[model samples]
Target chain A: DVKVTQSSRYLVKRTGEKVFLECVQDMDHENMFWYRQDPGLGLRLIYFSYDVKMKEKGDIPEGYSVSREKKERFSLILESASTNQTSMYLCASSPSKSTEAFFGQGTRLTVV
Target chain B: DQQVKQNSPSLSVQEGRISILNCDYTNSMFDYFLWYKKYPAEGPTFLISISSIKDKNEDGRFTVFLNKSAKHLSLHIVPSQPGDSAVYFCAAIGNTGFQKLVFGTGTRLLVSP
Candidate 1:
């Protein structure tokens, strides 16, 4: 079975603070993604990395950044956390573009 | 503009009955469709998928049907169980290998005993 693990299951941050969400996959998948899920907006992609040091912006990449220094780890960075940024963040990994993806237990973030 | 749409936000069905979930897309470029089931506080899990060339695909009690002309797809679960209750998301991917999928606002399905 494939295992995708997130650094934090829940997080609390203050406005204007920097926040980081980490994800690691044991399957050594080539593609990793970061998504933020809101109540009515669904899961919108924030960023994705196809390979180490290669990143691409998704539909909703504003105020967020990503790092993929290694194949097994991907990190999401919130430049300046705000109340509106509070939501559940999910990380997923896929071995190939056309294959099924495995996801980690999401991190529920609260910005006050 | 929500290229993919799941208009029904929620649905309820009795256990042992069939649960049908619908999804529609406006983008003609989308050639691959997938369904994912998500539980509260957990990431969505891959359920079923169908390609544009095929009209239907089945796995166990779950079946997926696609209508290319109407740009619609549906997921059917036979004999729905309490454990089947969850939020279902519909996603579409273009022909590109990058696999950037456009997802629809999910529908929450509840199975009653």
Candidate 2:
């Protein structure tokens, strides 16, 4: 079975703290993505990596950065947590651009 | 601006009945469409998909119908069970490879027995 695992299910961070959200896919897929889900806003892409060390910004990449040094791992970093940034962050992977994506359980982050 | 829209926020259906969820998109460049089901505290799961070339696609009890002219799509779940209750999101992808999908706000479905 294909699985995308996120490092945390819930997280709390101070307003000025820097936070990291890790994701690993065992499917060996080439494309990995990070999206933040909010009520009434749906899911907005943050960043995605098409290959190792290749990253692309999604619609909302402000105040965030990503790393993809390894093939199966992609990490989303919050440079500075803010209260408005609180939301459910999701990680997904797909074999290719035209394929359906498999998503992780998601991490609900609360920035105080 | 929201290119994809799920006008209905929620829908209720009886068990053994068909539940229909509708979605509309403003972008004509979108060529592929997908439907995802998400439960509370979990991520969205891919349900079904249809490309612009095909008007309909089916998987077991789930069916997705596309109307290219109107930029509309619908997901029909037959004999919906209580377990089918979840939030449904419709997504559209452009021709860009490594498809970056644009999603709707999602419609919550509740199936009652």
Candidate 3:
């Protein structure tokens, strides 16, 4: 089975603090993605990496950034946590664009 | 604007009834469409998918129907069970090969016994 793991399931931080949410996939997939899911808004893509060190901005990438240094790991970074940025973050990996993706359990972030 | 849209925000069905969830897309370039189911505090899981060329695809109790001309799709669940309650997201992808998927707002389905 394919597994995508998020380092933290829940996080709390003060506003203006820098936050790092880690994700790792064991499937050795070529594509990795970070998405933020909000109530009613559904899943909004933040960033996606097609290859090692290659990244593209998704629909919503304003307050966030991502890093894909290696094939099996992709990380999402919040430069400065804001109250409005509080939401559930999900990580996913897929073999290619046409294939189904495997997702991590997700990390709920709270900014105060 | 949302390229993919799920008009119904929520739907309720009794167990053993048929649950129909609808989705529409504005982009004509999309060649692949997929459905995902998500539970509270958990990430969205891939449920079923249908290619643009095919009209219907089935996997056990879950079936996906696609109409290329209307750019519409629907997911039908037969004999709905309590375990079927979750948020269903419809996503569309064009073969840009970059893997950028346009997703709908999602519809929450609740099955009651």
- Native RMSD of candidate 3 (Å): 0.9
Question: Runs in model 1 with CA error above 4 Å?
Answer: none
Residues A30-88, candidate 3: write the lDDT tens digits.
Answer: 99999999888888899999999999999899999999999999999999999999999
The alpha-carbon interface RMSD of model 2 comes to 1.2
Stretches of model 3 off by over 4 angstroms after superposition: none
Select the stronger candidate by DockQ from 1 and 2: 2
- RMSD to true structure for each model, in Å: 0.9, 1.0, 0.9
lDDT of 1 by residue, A1-112 (tens): 9999999999999999999999999998999999899977888999999999999999999999999999999999999999999999999998875557788999999999
* Winner of 2 and 3 under lDDT: 2
User: Candidate order by DockQ, highest to lowest?
Assistant: 2, 1, 3
**Sort by lDDT, top down from the best:** 2, 1, 3
Complex DockQ per candidate: 0.72, 0.75, 0.71
lDDT (tens digit, per residue) of candidate 2 on A1-112: 8999999999999999999999999988999999999989898999998999999999999999999999999999999899999999999998874469999999999998
Candidate 2 — which residues are off by over 4 angstroms?
A: none
Calculate each model's fnat, 2 decimals: 0.61, 0.73, 0.68
lDDT of 1 by residue, B9-113 (tens): 999999999999999999998899999999999989999999999999999999999999999999999989999999999999887778777789999999999
